[model samples]
Target chain A: MTVQLDFLKNVLYFSGLDLAEIESIDKLVFEKSAERGEMVLLEGESATDLYFVASGAVKVFKTSAEGKEQILSIVRPGESFNDVSIFDGGPNPASARAMGPVLLYGIKKNDIEAILRNHPRVVLNVINVLASRVRHLVSLVEDLSFKHVIGRVAKILFEQVGGGQMGRGPRLTQQEMAAMAGTAREVVGRSLKALEEEGAIKVDRNRIVITDKEALKRVMEVSS
Target chain B: MAEMPGIDREKCDGCGLCVIVCHCGALTMVDKSINIIETVECDWCTDCEAVCATGAISCPFEISIE
Candidate 1:
């Protein structure tokens, strides 16, 4: 149908395909939905399919035996996950959980392999995405190793602001910020308090306003 | 048994940042030094190792079977 083709056209991997190829690929795709907080994939599960996020968000994370969680990345709409696993036919490296109600498009490994064979350029795209993920992981490792808590918090805030001119950023809970910073909630609270004391930021009921962007950058620099 | 993370006492500044980052509660500070309290609870997520400011926590070397 035209609706399905339109959706396929928006996906980066299928963007190069013509109408006929899109339609053929669409036939091989299936839709899946998950409620908020639902587990979409489990770490160590066999990778049989690659998934595209049609709507909503999903958090990719690894869990400790004690039920502690370390989030790897968050997949937003139009992005995809499990490409590497599908290519290697290996188990999922991490688990994915729906942050909210989510809709996804899934393609089986065999179908994706066939498509890749026809369009080698798709391999380049996959590699590009994987490379970016590696870069992100490397930065995360660096942040965890070298950056202090305040520096990590500032970096995360700047990232959330999209590195644009500072203003009222997205509303996020303390717990959410803690998870992203790879620290405890208390640590985030203390850091935010310190930033607030320095007139660098303002914390107002689930939202943070960056009052002085330069001051925040100074905090990161001084710590680094 | 899985290899546990080893702490380099010489490098450890005892900042307790690793203790705060260790979600599994496997790490603790005693006498201004980091110690693995319960090895069984450690998931080797490398969270503590990643957050150590002094690179005090080193994960066990992993051998690739591939």
Candidate 2:
């Protein structure tokens, strides 16, 4: 199958590559699709290629002793999965499942290494991505320790409200918000009630409408 | 859907095992005791509870702020 070099060029890692280099890199990359509920990777399996989401979403999670799966991260389009394990020479640390119909680009580590050697810009881009991940992890650690559960839940809703079009929506279900916050579903339910009573936000089904962004930010400002 | 295991500051002996066993890097050694960091990645797996020997960990069924 022909690789979509032009499309690949738009991804940050490939933006600096020339057409010929893009074609060469694309030759080593393959496209794959997964339906919702399909496992993308098995935990403890050898890590081989990194999967970049081109469309749809995936959930990274691991099974607990009680056989309950704990979601570790959500991978959206323009992001890649299995990065940390690949860098550590370790097996896949977690399993991934397609949150919905997903399309991904699979690139082997060797190919990525070769590209990095030739085009150092790609390495910088990857480093930026990994650094951002580390920062996010660090922030989460801080939130768990210092912030009150209510503040954490409110902050979660506020953060999910991005700029324009996407921000104004119905309130999300307590379960989904709790899933994203890594807390109990009821914790979210209670927090939403508190916020609603305080006129912080309005909850409607699974959508959370940010009625007062400033007030919500104040609610999240409490230290643990 | 459980409260994340809580760390008893007085009981924890500053051992970092919880930090070591946590797959999502949710547990951190803060001031010599184990503390859970709220990352979107945390799944409340209770690994810290399983690893803690002092019985300092507990996952409450609820966290009501009101």
RMSD of each: 19.0, 18.6
Clashes of 1: 0
What docking grade does candidate 1 earn? incorrect
TM-score for all models, in order of appearance: 0.54, 0.53
Model 1, span A62-101: residue lDDT tens: 8778675666776766789887688777899999987656
Which one wins on TM-score?
A: 1
> Can you tell me which runs of candidate 1 are displaced by over 4 Å?
A150-224, B1-66
lDDT of each: 0.72, 0.68
**Cα DockQ of the candidate 1 complex:** 0.01
Scoring each candidate complex against the real one, what DockQ results? Answer: 0.01, 0.02
Q: What is candidate 2's lDDT per residue for A22-55, written digit by digit as tens?
A: 8888888889899767899999999788888777
Chain A TM-scores, candidates in order: 0.67, 0.65
Q: Can you write out model 2's per-residue Cα lDDT over B1-66, one digit (the tens) per residue?
A: 323556678888875656754667777787887777767565654445544556566443221111
If you assessed candidate 2 against the hidden native complex, which CAPRI class would it receive? incorrect
Cα miss at A123, model 1 (Å)? Answer: 1.7
